[model samples]
Target chain A: MPHLTLEYTANLGLDADAALLALNHALAGSGLFEEADIKSRAVPLHSFRSGTAATPRAFAHARLALMPGRDAASKRHLADALLAALSAQVSSPGLETQLCVELQEIEADCYAKEYRHG
Target chain B: MPHLTLEYTANLGLDADAALLALNHALAGSGLFEEADIKSRAVPLHSFRSGTAATPRAFAHARLALMPGRDAASKRHLADALLAALSAQVSSPGLETQLCVELQEIEADCYAKEYRHG
Candidate 1:
């Protein structure tokens, strides 16, 4: 199972639902996960400071959590894909925005998931 | 720096802001992270399916991301602490809910952060 979370500064005036759908579609389109198994959500940050105080900037950070085993190259590809989707769907025009995507491997031994959405 | 994110089902009718604060405080109180370095946010899922469709249930998942290097035991402690905080602050009454906490270490070589909130 892959869970992708996008957190964006609230001031950007982006639609969280649309962003989530875009990223979820991107992940599913990558053929990296089953469409049904992909879980994506977005959070808006009302109070966040990014870059230097001299310039008011915005940021969107995505964290992809998946089971450990993927090769580094594949993970990098996933991050890049997610980043592209975020930039296209979530980034606001006329705003200095920094976008980040991080891939984190969840250790199987320590991780536990019980899905009952059958 | 550590970033903790809580993703909960929207049907639970929980307060996302309170949960974020509780989790942030828990992480800071653990003394494992500086108060200023702990960033926590919550996302409420409006559309989600958990377990069997026969029973409508909810789930709250927390992913803790930190720089790689903490030992297994320490990470377990952190997870337990986080789970406790989430259960205390976010779980709704009269709903069958599942709570999960996962610690994912960010590979230092691949991770990058640029904070300007000074």
Candidate 2:
């Protein structure tokens, strides 16, 4: 189960939904996950602070949570793919935007889910 | 840096911000993290699907992202604490609520931030 969450600062003028889809595509293109199983969402951050200075900053952070089992190398590969998509999505000329992608292993034993169809 | 996010269903009878504060308190009480450095937020899900049946379901899932170095026991302790607080906060009569707490380690090298004070 790959649950992708993209949290971006409000100052960043990027379409959060589009950015999420792009990142989802990047994950899907990696051949490591199924497009249908990836649950993606975006959160637009309005109030946030980073570092020790008020020199104006923005960021887009994405966290991908997946079922535990992937090797370290494969995890890094997924992280790389997502970071690139997030970086490109929030790229701005005059704004110093920090982008990060983190991977978390969801415990298969503790995780539960169900699918309902109409 | 420890970033915490609590995602829950909107139908749950709970104050998002209040629940976030309680969770923050739980994490702070763990004595494994600094209260000031804890960045926590909540996302209320208006539209979501959980299981195969439409019998109504609710959940409160929290993720804690911290700098790597904690042991398994310590991590479990933190998760347990948060889960307890979350369960107590989201308890309702005749409603099935799923609760989960996952811990993630933040790579210090990849994380960037700035803080400004008045």
lDDT of 1: 0.75
DockQ (C-alpha based) per candidate is 0.14, 0.09
Over 4 Å off in model 1, which ranges? B1-6, B13-59, B63-100, B104-118
- Measured over all alpha carbons after superposition, the RMSD of each candidate to the real structure, in angstroms, is 6.8, 6.7
Q: Write the per-residue lDDT of candidate 2 for residues A34-70, one digit (tens) a residue.
A: 8899999998875454432335566667878788777
The TM-score of predicted model 1 comes to 0.61
- At residue A47, candidate 2 shows an lDDT of 47
Task: Please give, for residues A1-118, the per-residue lDDT of candidate 1 as tens digits.
Answer: 5777778898786777677777887787778776655666676788888755767688889988788888888888888888898888764677788899998777764554444331
Candidate 1 lDDT for residue B26: 80
TM-score of 2: 0.59
Q: Say what the interface RMSD of candidate 2 is.
A: 7.0
lDDT of 2 at B2: 74
